[model samples]
Target chain A: MGREDKAMVKKAEAATGADNRPFLFRRHDAGTIREAYRKMLLIRAFEEGAENAYMRGLVHGTMHLSIGQEASAVGVGLALRDDDQITSTHRGHGHSIAKGAEVKRMFAEFFGKETGYCRGRGGSMHIADVSKGNLGANGIVGGGIPIAVGAALSARRLGNGKVVVCFFGDGANNEGAFHEALNMAAIWKLPVVFVCENNGYGMSTSQARATASATIAERAGAYAMPGRTIDGNDLSAVAEATEDAVSRARNGEGPSLIELKTYRWRGHSKSDRNRYRTKEEIDHWMTENDPVKRIEADLVAFGILDEAGLDAVRASVAEEIEAGIAFAKESPSPDPADLERFVYTEGA
Target chain B: MDQPVRELSYAEAIREAMAIALERDERVVVMGEDIGVYGGAFQVTGDLIERFGPDRIIDTPISELGGAGIAVGAAVTGLRPIFEFQFSDFATLAMEQIVNQAAKMRFMLGGSVSVPVVMRFPAGSGTGAAAQHSQSLEAWFGHVPGLKVVQPTTPEDAKGLLLAALEDPDPVMIFEHKLLYKTRGPVPEGAYTTPIGKAEIRRKGRDVTVVATGVMVSRALEAANELAAEGIEVEVIDLRTVRPIDTPAIVESVIRTHRLCIVHEAVKTLGIGAEISARIAESEAFDYLDAPIVRLGGAETPIPYNPDLEKAAVPQVPGIVAALRDLATGRR
Candidate 1:
């Protein structure tokens, strides 16, 4: 369907059908689901802590929190192997978390400590851990699209059985780079999945006003590629859709654009004053489709661990975050002489 | 030994060089906005796609920022990308990729990778394309670290400079003037890489040392002949590579002639001439200066559309002659 028909179809399904449920697995493990739930909680706790620190004038520079969009990050990140690469957006704490960044180092980075990933040089928008295949969290809108295309091109040319998952917002789809990168990836059959985390806004402007289409994924048809949108709040649905895209890319089927219908919990940045969005809208999602709460209730209903286990996970994650803050606080700043150090190769 | 063909223009020399490079190196790809099927803005890369196919000769979207960033990413992944900016003026759009990213990658990665990328721009003002299209921004890049900057005046230098840039394990910016493309000169056939960070003495004389760059090299030669009629000998040096400058060439010529005049197409204030003047002033050649070192560059104003006004904006044949005359007579 065209993008215009997508939301209408979704609304009609919401009114008529029973809530979509997956078939119960005969051999699904409770530990695995619990671990995923724990990760989502940690991401929430970590991002909320960062937002509080930013307000108290402790964290330097700006931050983009992914509090409300935990399931999309955990779902897709869980589906990929260690060697597969992924490019993230500015609101990318959850993406980094899924790629397995230490909570302490992330806190250290936000604190501008030398022990951070970028040596504290790159702030929130530029965090990177290439060892984990997180290329980076890009600052410019639609910036990561082209870089991910290059990575996919390299992987395809080298015959490396790796696929790249490129995460961009709805606003990025409006950029020319998105279309250019998607078209190139399509024609070349590059091993890439264009993951559009279509959270409502692309910064101040609403997605409806900025984009002509109803959804970013439907626009992928013009490139003659498969496009699908999943309930980004549903971990199982997101994981299945993403796994399909990654597997297709690895099997030499070119690229696929998947739109994860998610939302950001906090303001666009640290200093958001809630001028554009309302508390009522925030309350609606917080009460109904909160990813962490839904997954927690689902696990509980399935006879997984009880409230005691969840509380223990929270305590341990909090202590780890505190240690990371301490580590960053105790870490030394880079010397002034080091500023002129890395500008060029000293010699051949 | 016989030369391969007749005289070729500087622009044609560049095209031949790119064709040879693309033919020889599979990793070499040419990318720009209108370069692929459109034949480029100046036709320097005319019909390359027909020869090399679209994979190697790519016509990128009009997003210079995105194109440049993609080139940087491709370079890091072991591709030799030859990026073309339609005009030097449009380079402002891609400066972030060139200045911050391309120039900083090697160092940041702890020398793990090399940015073997070449960027070509149609620099200088001769084709009355007005302010937005015509500009000379090479000096801005030459001042930056980790970049090898070049400005070739003749066809021979064009071929040699591009070949040299392709071989170097660094990012190189080549400023080819719009006027010098049709200006033909002898160019050897096949592939040859000139040594970068070096200068060539284009003309020889004694009384005054005239250090010129880009288009100014030919103008300086014309001025030397005019000065020769007045019994004033002048030596001309073409600074092929502007950065990591060949200070020894300028200092040696200055020591012999005892007078130095630095000329360029950029504005006089804080231009490459100013840097050359500083180097000469600080070097041992300071004592040998019989007259104060002179700098002749673009005027401190926008490039005018009027042909005469445009000529007055930068160093002309007469400006070099007058500067040489004053220097030879030991006058400021």
Candidate 2:
């Protein structure tokens, strides 16, 4: 291993202390910890596969890859039930995987096949699996924020014990929808958690340049809600923050805002030239603050899994991703004649 | 024995429809600005909060975009939300939610979901409320593919169509003329639905077909009465729904009359008239046209504050009479 990698591992071990129990180990059993690891690995592998497919000209259009933000997605997902809802953003493959979506259907959607989540109509920007409580991944900035508020309103009115988690990027924090949705959710005391994955940049416009507030979470105070900012690379921090927010929502105590300070390892989209940021900055985040390595380090320090066990997890995730891609490649293309079928409800 | 139908104003008819919907379904909710204790800006939702309470008849803050989006989300999640825009002109502020979200949600989700949202707009220009408040922009919503746009002219239709919109599995935009609120008509008691996309023939004549929508339907009828005295009988067809327009009814009317005159309160250029005219020209009715189709609509300007100018901006009864007379005669 490289000296820098070894130093990061030693630092992670030192943070665990003599008892050697990470924050995740304190809250969850070994099984849940392993599952979280699998989900995060699955997200990374799925996006890597999607990236490869895009490079090979197998996928059309562009996609926003959430490569280094797996911990935030899987961490938030670990705190909620299967029935609890989420409204995702454009960089939503990780969120989808963490929320229990079948990778094959997601791949089929990316491939524009008939068996896809949106029947190949929505493609990557609008993947939705409502049955599993993913309302949708919106193309418009801050589009899904109000929708999540509405879903929470329905949950409150119906007396259903469901909480909605809304996921967005640092860019969406500036949108009027974000403020309006947060204000309404607060006044109505709706059950919702707003998770902002602040990956530093919004399509090359850094949050420092775009946002007025020092921290995105501080804006939540204006809406009369609790807000917190934490290191997103730490999976335990994300899980703990989400658990608190979800508990408050489920208890009818209203919404909370959590700012996950992380970084993206890829460009915003396929067409993005690396002109906005320097290579040294990207390399710093990739090597020092990688979410996958942090989790692996925590697991290893706590003795949840040995090196061979970690390799086994990686191999299994790789196999699942390959299988999902193959299923997408073999899926049938939708008939052109049925283009207008889902435009409106039948017999309405 | 048939139950006696009682006379009710357009506003009362709309309120009765909401009351019935709330009573029948637990999922139905009514939300808008000043719609609770204040009873709406136009007083259309009078005393509804007392009966249904604040939870069902929600009074939202002055956030059109946010309120509209919340309604879309609520509808997608299984709540039947009836969202009211204070004025039809306010829809411009919430177009993103209406066009991109509510209209496209089902298609984007591959039909796994449906947004059963009903938005009511108090439309048209008779009131002194100038440019912003007075607009008959039903044509705008009609132009959209996924939306069902309807203009209910009478008290009976106002109640019936509102009920029908609640039952629809997709978003329905109802443009209610503000001036028609006080107009009374026979409205049947209890739950009843008027079929959307069906134009009703108010008065059938053999001379010329007068196609009109919203408040213009009543004006067309008045013009028909005035023209009948001069031996120029005019047929008045109330185009209740604009989108998914009753093309068959219009084609049949044009075929019988051999002449057509389209009237609307919106601006004439690229308005609903243009769409109707193009449809007739493409259909079998085109062969039967004796005179070129005449269109009488609003002037190409924002509604003015002056009472006379406001009246002159849109097609009044006198304007409809003159247009129909021109079409019936050889004059262009």
> Per-candidate DockQ versus the true complex?
0.28, 0.82
**Top model number, lDDT:** 2
lDDT of 1: 0.81
The per-prediction i-RMS, to one decimal, reads 3.3, 0.7
Ten residues in a row with the worst lDDT in model 2 chain B?
B1-10
Against the true structure, whose TM-score is highest?
A: 2
Candidate 2 overall lDDT versus native = 0.93
Q: What TM-score results for chain B in every one of the models? A: 0.97, 0.99
- Tens digits of per-residue lDDT, candidate 1, B1-332, equal 25575688887899999999999987788889889778998889988889999888888777677677677666756678898998888889877778876786555433445778899989888777666777788889988988889988889889989988888778899988888878999889888877788899988888999899888888999999898999998999999888879999999999999999988887788889999999999999999989888898888988888887877788889878988898788667
